[model samples]
Target chain A: MVRRSREPVLWAMFSGGGMIAALLLPATVAVLWIAAPLGWVEAPSYEGLRLLFLHPIGRLSLFAVATLSFFHWAHRFRYTVYDGLQLYHLSQLIAILTYSIAVALTVIAGFVLVTTG
Target chain B: MAKALNAGYKRHYPKWHRERVPIFWWLRSASYVKFMFRELTSLFVAYAAGLLLVQAWVLGQGAAAHARLLNWLSHPAVVTWHVILLATLLFHTVTWLNLTPQALVLRLGRWRVPKTVVWAGHYAAWLVLSLVIVCLFVGVA
Candidate 1:
């Protein structure tokens, strides 16, 4: 019996993350980092943002984007180390480290999202 | 007799050797450099997500902490870094969306959707999503 490789699952997450990042990250970065800071757009007040996060939908969407983006980073960074650094000998270690970091961050993000208003 | 001869010949052959690819091989080609740049965008994507997590955590810490975060974000150096981050993110968005038509093939009954149309559809969706997010954050303030 052949043991299935988990590459497909990781690849699916990476693909989804890439799609989400593409569709969402631009405006997010623009608004949060650039426009709001530069006063080109009004920044969301602390109270306003907190109220937004208090809603289930906002928390869920934020969690989904952050989690998927991290997985995307893990998958891509795994390969970047493999091919870019030519560390094929340490492939298993790299895979474990990257995915573990993503999972750990996901847990932290989830905890914060759940506990916070 | 032929099998015996072939087996003996194989025993005398040297092991195959493959040349090691240099770590900076991608830098040698324009397209390879572009590919590496695209791959490197994952770092910024991860950074953005991590920043969001931090922001959420700060939000939970109370308004003083959140205000501190906002002040930090508004600093000249930090804003400069964000400008660079935004450029890389837009690059990621454009390259990722451009590749979508190739990855996803759309069909309507017997007719295949043109790649241009598929490509345009993704861009349209992206624009709408960007608008939605911008409104959610900016308009509400």
Candidate 2:
């Protein structure tokens, strides 16, 4: 019933890729928290995955972080817009447009990483 | 049978005041607890970025660069920042985990998991995961 009910437009923003990004964030942080002090590798680098940080894996990681982060902000911001701005006519539209840009920017970042790599 | 009173309870309600207001009320509501968590979660953004910078420098110069980055991070100012950011991030992560169920559409048969269960499960998972990670680090060290 809850699912079938008209979900608050703000809630919809979280579902399509936004939720995925939110879920990804903590996992990535946990990984960083673990990877950093543990001396997982003898030396880290900027090169490719095998070589260092500046590599493909690093670039991919950067893009992933940025993309996910944006989506998280987008979803949360939608709620803020909804509650703060009493412009009922425009709230839903703003939410949609915000999420659209967030996803689009995320995609572009992904493209950049893959192409560059 | 209950009699319908024409007048509303007690005193007449005061007229609503009109003026432009600030967003501060948004921060004070109980529901804002979730928003606070979501807002605070942005720390992960900084965490990831910081890690990338360290790795970037390290990768660009090899071992020496990596070592220097580590040393830089160890500075008192940087350490203080890391400590504060780390605390904020963990709180956000934990709160987000707690709220995941409400945000998600999960059902078992006709019954949905209680929000309490959902929140507790997240805390349990986090505890288990963090413990395991800490153990691995300790073992390696």
Candidate 3:
């Protein structure tokens, strides 16, 4: 019997994350890091931003993006190391480490999102 | 009888081995280099998500902590880093969207959607989503 490869599941996450990052990260980074700090856009008051994040929808969206993005990183970085670095001998170890880190970060992000006001 | 006669074939035959690829092979071609850079964009993606997570964590700490994060972001070095991040992210976006037509083949009944149309649609969606995010941040929405 052939064991099923889990690559498809990881690839799905990778593509989904890539899509979300492509669609959202540019504007998010531009607004938060560039425009807001430079006074090109009105920066949200800390209280206002906090209240938004404290809302359930805000928390859910943040969690979704952060978690998917991390998984995207894990899948890509795993292949980068495997092929780019030619570390085929350590494939199993690399897969484990990359996905584990992604999962760990997701947990931390979830906790922060849940606890934050 | 044939199986018994061929039982020692493995011992007589030489093993086949794959040619080793050079570690820096991606540097040899422009396209390969671009692909490597595209893969490298994942790091920036992770960085952006991690930064947002940190921001959320800081927001929970207190107003002073959140303010400190904003102040830190305004520093020259950090701002420069973010500029690089934005560039890399845009590269990722363009490359990813360009590949969408290949990955997704749309059919309108018997007529297939034109690749150009599919490609343009992705770009349009990307533009709209980006605008939406910007509007959210700017409190326009």
Candidate 4:
């Protein structure tokens, strides 16, 4: 029997992450970069944001976003190097390194979020 | 005899020259560059989320730590990077919204959802989600 490919699973996460990132990232950037520095809107208080993150929902949300976004980058960058840069010969190594980093970072995010408080 | 047969087959099926892709092939077309840039935005997206993870960690450390993190975020270099991230991510957002219809096709009974409706739906979701996050941060219920 032939082995089944895991590409679908990774692609699913990549596409899901892409959707969420596309929807939410711009607004988040607006608040952090544009609004806070320029005062287009009153900047968020550190304590207030902190308290928000203290909630379980907030922590989980951040973890989901961070992990998903990392996977998205890993998937896209993998293809970029494979096709865009034409490194098909290094496919196995590239996939291993890219996904390992994404998984590692995601684990770090989860650990930090859960244990920090 | 074998050599002669192989030579005849080679002549019958001429191999075409392969075109080499240049290092900067992406620069040759506007659309290719746009697509590559869109793919590149994934890195910025991940970076932003990583910053948030750091923020959550610092927030748990207490006010002093949180304050220090905020101070660091305000540095000139960090601010400049954030600015570039914002611009590129905005481009990512717009392109993503436009491409959603292509990715997801919804049909209601026999009728297909209009592409415009799909685009509008993405924007609407973005608006709602952004409002909720903003509200939560601003201490509004």
DockQ of each: 0.76, 0.22, 0.69, 0.57
lDDT of 1 by residue, B1-141 (tens): 766767565535687797989989998999999999999999999999889878887888999999999999999999999999999999999999999889999999999999999999999999999999888887669
Q: Evaluate model 1: give its lDDT.
A: 0.90
TM-score of chain B of 2: 0.62
What fraction of native interface contacts is shared by candidate 1?
0.84
Residue range A3-92, candidate 4, lDDT tens digits: 999999999889888888888777777776566766666768776787677688888888888998999999999988777887778999
Candidate with best DockQ:
1
True contacts kept of each: 0.84, 0.12, 0.78, 0.63
- Classified by CAPRI criteria, candidate 1 counts as medium
Model 1, B41: alpha-carbon shift in Å?
0.4
Candidate 2 segments whose C-alpha is farther than 4 A from its true place: A1-66, A77-117, B1-19, B26-40, B43-50, B53-57, B128-141
What is residue A77's positional error in candidate 3, in angstroms?
Answer: 0.9
What lDDT tens digits, residue by residue, belong to model 4 across residues B15-127?
Answer: 77968787678988999998899899899989889888888888888889977877777787878888899898888788888898898899999999998899899989988
For candidate 3 chain B, the 10 contiguous residues with the lowest summed lDDT are B7-16
Residue runs of model 1 more than 4 Å from their true location after superposition: B1-14
Provide the lowest-lDDT 10-residue window in model 2 chain B: B132-141
lDDT of 1 by residue, A1-117 (tens): 999999999999999999999999889889988899899987888777876665688789889999999999999999998999999899999999999999998999899899885
State each model's CA lDDT, in order. Answer: 0.90, 0.55, 0.90, 0.84
Pick the lDDT winner: 1
For each prediction, how big is the interface RMSD?
A: 1.1, 5.7, 1.8, 2.1
Candidate 3 lDDT, B74-128, residue by residue in tens = 8989988999999999999999999999999999899999999999999999999
Leading candidate by TM-score: 1
